[model samples]
Target chain A: MIQFSNYDIISNLLFATQWTILLSLAAFIGGTSVALLLTAMRLTRNPAMQTVVRIYVELFQGTPLLMQMFLCFFGLSMLGYEISAWSAAILSLTCFTSAFLVEIWRGCIDTLPKGQWEACRCLGLSFLQTLRHIILPQAIRVATAPTVGFSVQVIKGTALASVIGFVELTKVGTMLNNATFEPFKVFTLVALIYFALCYPLSLYSKHLEKKFNVSR
Target chain B: MSLVNLHQVHKYYGDLHVLKGIDLDIKAGEVVSIIGKSGSGKSTLLRCINGLEEYQQGGITVDGNEVTTEDIQVRRLALSVGMIFQNFNLFPHMTVGENIMLAPTIVLKKSKAEAEEIARAMLLKVGLEEKFDSYPEKLSGGQQQRVAIARALAMSPKVLLCDEITSALDPELVGEVLKVLEQLAKEGMTLVLVTHEMNFARDVGSKVVFMHQGKVWEEGDSKTLLSDPQTDELKQFIGAVL
Candidate 1:
């Protein structure tokens, strides 16, 4: 049995935490970009495009994230398409995050009065200009707290990626537990790491929710 | 030229008819006030002129541009028509000046400095030059409506359509807004107002259009028609309102 020191264990866990953070940021950025495009599509007058986006949102949001991960990783391979665990995790996670995010943003946008859009239209603003100059600036302020709150979900969600053989914090913890024979210690540390990463965001979201609601 | 012409214009809200074959013409440099009870489609008529509401039938022309729901047509029509709402739809995200400048800077493609100069001039015109940096939320109902007027004026549209522009104000605030509209009317700005201020309509408005059930029930010189009340409906309306 190879012996592992406390420093070695802690350092390895910290390194794995780095991957967890990296995955979360990548997923968030990719998800937001995709969500923006989908949000635009959903708002368009083209019913077919709106329907397509609606179905896309429903398909991803209606399903389990774990199942999505499995399908992206193993299902694709089963069909003879080569894909890496990391790519699969990112891909499935982006879709999952975007599904929730698009709805969250839509709720924020809808909170504004219909008169805002009408006002923009009468000013001769094109739809895109209205969104860019007026609607989104206001909506983004309203969306901030909810968007931050949703990020914690993304960070916690990255743990499920471990089940797909991605060597993130949870996966490394499982491996460490097997070698160290200390579920109480290894998993406790893993859980604590996630708490450290997610707690501030949760607090910040609550703070912002109170701040924006009060100011507005 | 007739700055705005509506010939047998018809509008429908789903199966319910909103504007029933309305025909009216508004010439340049005239102040026309539209008045009626709720659901009479006075507001709908004002909205139709600005291309905000699409009619199921008939045609509307503003400064030689046809009013249509098509994006290009609406954009073209906007150059000729400006509208102020009862709720004072100033962009809350923008400063008083930015709210005034946004349309010109974007739609009219004015340079930022030029837009700001125009915005300042409009703010001065509305007597809110000191509030150029203030946000809409910080202002009172009267102040915000003034800012909205300034915003509309910044576009330099040939015709300004006001839809019950004072209905949302407090009774005290109503005077301030009416005072501004009265001033604009004196300046011969070709104002079209859907209003309830009978006194202001009579005193400042050149014409009063009484709308009933989505049709022009009676219309004529404001001072005479409002005082005389030609139709029984107008008499009833005046009696009910007064």
Candidate 2:
């Protein structure tokens, strides 16, 4: 049985936690923008636009993220793209995150009643004007909770990037565990770090939802 | 020239026919009440006038622009033809002032300050000045309906259509909405109303049109139609209700 000092293992895990947060943030921002576009397209009446959005959502939702990561990391490099693990991880996570975010936002939009549409129409506000002023303001109340809660999923999802040789917290912990042959101790620290990042965000989301519901 | 005209308007809901060849004309400063049993096409006729509902076959000109062909033009025409719905359809998120000011600011291009002033005056006109900052849910049923009337009047519509505006309210609350309508009619705002209140039909309406089975059975001066002997259908209807 191999063994290592406690300080060595704990320090290595602590150092990699920062990279996990950074990777999560990059994936989150990239995903949210794409999701906004997908959701808008989903709401459109144009058949072609809706079809494209539906295909995009289905494509991402249908495939496993592990397969997507493998394709992003290995397949692109084979095609002479010369992508880094960081870029591959970001791309895969962004696509995966977008599909779910689009669905969450669409649910928020659906919660609005049909009468709101008629009320805006009779007031002579153009479609965009009505969306910007009337619909979106109300939708924001609903979208806030799920959006923040989804951030936890994003953070957890970044751990999968470790399989592609991305040096996030999980990857670093795996490397440390291999050097010291202490899987239980190293993985425990990694799990705690992930908890630290996600738990606060989860609480904040719940708080926001309760506050908004009461105000409404 | 009449402020509003509809010639042989017919609206169909798939296989269910709603408005069957409705012909109507309203002159300036006229207050016409349409009374009928439920499902008698009273609300559909009002909705068609405001361009809220489309008719399959007919000509509808409100102040002269054809509404059936273009929704945008109908919207433009709707600027001068305001409507009040049975449910009061107010924007629940916005304040009473914001609800009244939205159309003027967006559609009429009025400045925010100008819109606010118009909104304030309108709310005062409807006896809702104190509730300007309140949301629709915060207000009572009568107050919300009054705010809806104020919102419609803020557009400076030449013709106003009230589609069972008081039906959703409590018996006591109904008076507050009708009182506001009475004041608007008194001030010479051309109005068309779909109402169940027989007293309102007899007192405030200069002309009464009784609709039965999607057609106007009889139409004449309010006093003549309500008091004097008429068709058997009218006799039975009045007998059943009274």
Best by TM-score, which number? Answer: 1
DockQ of 2: 0.47
User: How do the residues A50-156 of candidate 1 rate in per-residue lDDT, one tens digit apiece?
Assistant: 99889999999999999999999999999999999899999999999999999999999999999998888888999999899988999999999999999999999
Model 1: per-residue Cα lDDT over B1-242, one tens digit each: 78889999999989999999888988999999999999999988998888888899999988877889888888888887888998988888888988999999999999999999999988888888999999899999999999999988888889999988888889998988888888888788999999889898899989999999989999999999988987999999999999
Q: Chain B TM-score in candidate 2, rounded to 2 decimals?
A: 0.96
Please name the candidate that would achieve the greatest lDDT relative to the true structure.
Answer: 1
Q: How far does residue B159 in candidate 1 sit from its true spot (Å)? A: 0.6
Q: Number of clashing pairs, model 1?
A: 0
Tens digits of per-residue lDDT, candidate 2, A107-176, equal 9999998767666666666667778878888888899999999999999999999999999899999898
Which 10-residue window of candidate 1 chain B scores lowest in summed lDDT? B71-80
Listed models, DockQ each: 0.78, 0.47
User: What is the lDDT for B72 in model 2?
Assistant: 75
